[model samples]
Target: MSTAFDILVALGGLACAGIALVAGNRIGSVAAFVIMGFFVALAWVRLGAPDVALAEAAIGAGLTGALLLRSANRLGPVREAGVPIAVHGIAACLSLALAGGIVWAFATGTAEAVYPSLVAARVGESGVSNPVTAVLLNFRAWDTLLEVAVLVVALLLVSGLAPVRIAPAPPSELVLPFLRIVVPVAVLLAGHLLWKGATAPGGAFQAAALLTGGGLALALCGLLGAGRRTGHVLVLAGLGGLALFLAAALGAAILTGGLLDYPAGSAKVWIIAIESALTLSIAAMLVSLFLGPSEGVRDDR
Candidate 1:
């Protein structure tokens, strides 16, 4: 009694996985990976998780594919014949064996749902109906907070590598008009997602991804350019979320006697505020990553 959607999802998964394995070149592998991401997104929707699907389609497939393609362009085309046959064989065998073992374990394992009581007990206090949102933003806020820090640090390290130097060139007129319309719309959408995340599936990660996409669109179209200096404002933007969260948490200790202990009256507001800041910081960090050390020509038409 599988629905058509379920059948399509299953077929898509098999197709993507099979293509990934059989692909002989780097380009083919990249293509397969992108398709796999799309299929994964569909699977997420089939499993009744729209937020995960959106994130998968945006960041997992869209941004990841762009990064891979950009890297490949810089590295030049792969020379298949130049690779050693013995090395390829060894790599293939090892990969296949590892994948097989993982599959076997999952197939044989008795799955047990643990920790439901804990989640159910805390759900009401978390200020959200969605259990996943509750766990992500309230129960496990520290993890999410630190993850934002990690993304910021990674961007800073990349920026420090070569200094930012944007090429001086005018982007095509054709690209500008499209960006002008799209960027504002993207910003509005990101804000909406961030706000809705409290009770719904949308959240900081999805908002950040859309915001990142908008920034990237601007950079790609030559509307925004990188320079030698990582301005104090940009640096602050990167650390702002973590700073705000820490400050708020520590400030609450004076009133509540514990760090990160929001006053009972406005816990939801505080969490939402922190998530908004996180969305901004995460978006900026992701955009900076694509911009790299900053010496590159990006033409959009």
Candidate 2:
């Protein structure tokens, strides 16, 4: 059954990916890509990586789909463009070669797995019950730190582009009440996910994505604006994680003699603090990415 399920997921994901690439309309392509993301998440779960599955669902599928849909709506409909038969043939051959190479590499690769055991042996020192969390927040903290920095850089680049805001649609009466309930629930869930991350398959990225989803809902309903002064709040929020993480890194280096090395028995506290800050920052950054440049006027009505 498990093998069959995995096969089904693989096929479904491939089908969706193909549809996404070849769909005649932007909306159709985006929808197909979203479905592909979900299928990929399922594949991750089947591979025994629930943490990856959650991230795939939240960031790869949900947040990315939302961004693509918004971009598609702003750009209007996609027009069909003809491709030269020779170009299409060349592209297909290159794609097949790439796919074949990837398959060969995976099939021939040595299954020497040392990292899992290393993580298990050192997890107690990492101050987190979850092995994945320990690896991300402790053993491989530099990677996570750089990931946050990448998000910060992406936001700066987007801001520099000075993209215009697509005037929001009229606020819907029904959405307001729905958002009131959903937004609070999203906040509560984000908090829970952040807290649970140390022991479970939840983490900053997933929690932040949920929080961003809530913020997007509010913005779409016109209850939030992207004005310059108001956007400063988001800018601060976006920087908070990186700032706090750097401070912690420097403090650790000074006190423990190594960067990101937490003092004995205090690793959990530091990791949790950083994750909390990152959750907020990531959410703010994502929302601001969707909002684009500020309109210089409040529109919370």
How much lDDT does each candidate structure score? 0.77, 0.89
In the range 1-301, model 1's lDDT, one tens digit per residue, is 5598789888987798789767877678778889999999999998888989988998898888877766655565666667688998998899999999999998998877566678988788877766777777777877776777787778678656643333435777687788888999999999988888877778888998999889888877666745535434455676787788777778778878976666776778888888888888777777767666455334321
**Candidate 2 TM-score over all chains jointly:** 0.93
Per-candidate TM-scores read: 0.82, 0.93
List ranges where model 1 is wrong by over 4 Å. Answer: 1-4, 18-27, 79-112, 163-169, 229-235, 252-257, 293-301
What are the per-residue Cα lDDT tens digits for candidate 2 across 1-301?
9889899999999999999988988889999999999999999999999999999999999999988987787674455667888999999999999999999999999987899999989999999999999999999999999999999998888777656665678877788789989999999999999999999999899899999989988888777864576577887889888999999999999999999999999999999999999999999999988887465243322
User: By TM-score, how accurate is candidate 1?
Assistant: 0.82
Top-TM-score structure, candidate number: 2
Candidate 2 Cα outliers beyond 4 Å, as residue runs:
76-90, 296-301
Pull out the clashing pairs in model 2: none
Which number leads on lDDT?
2
Prediction-by-prediction clash tally: 0, 0
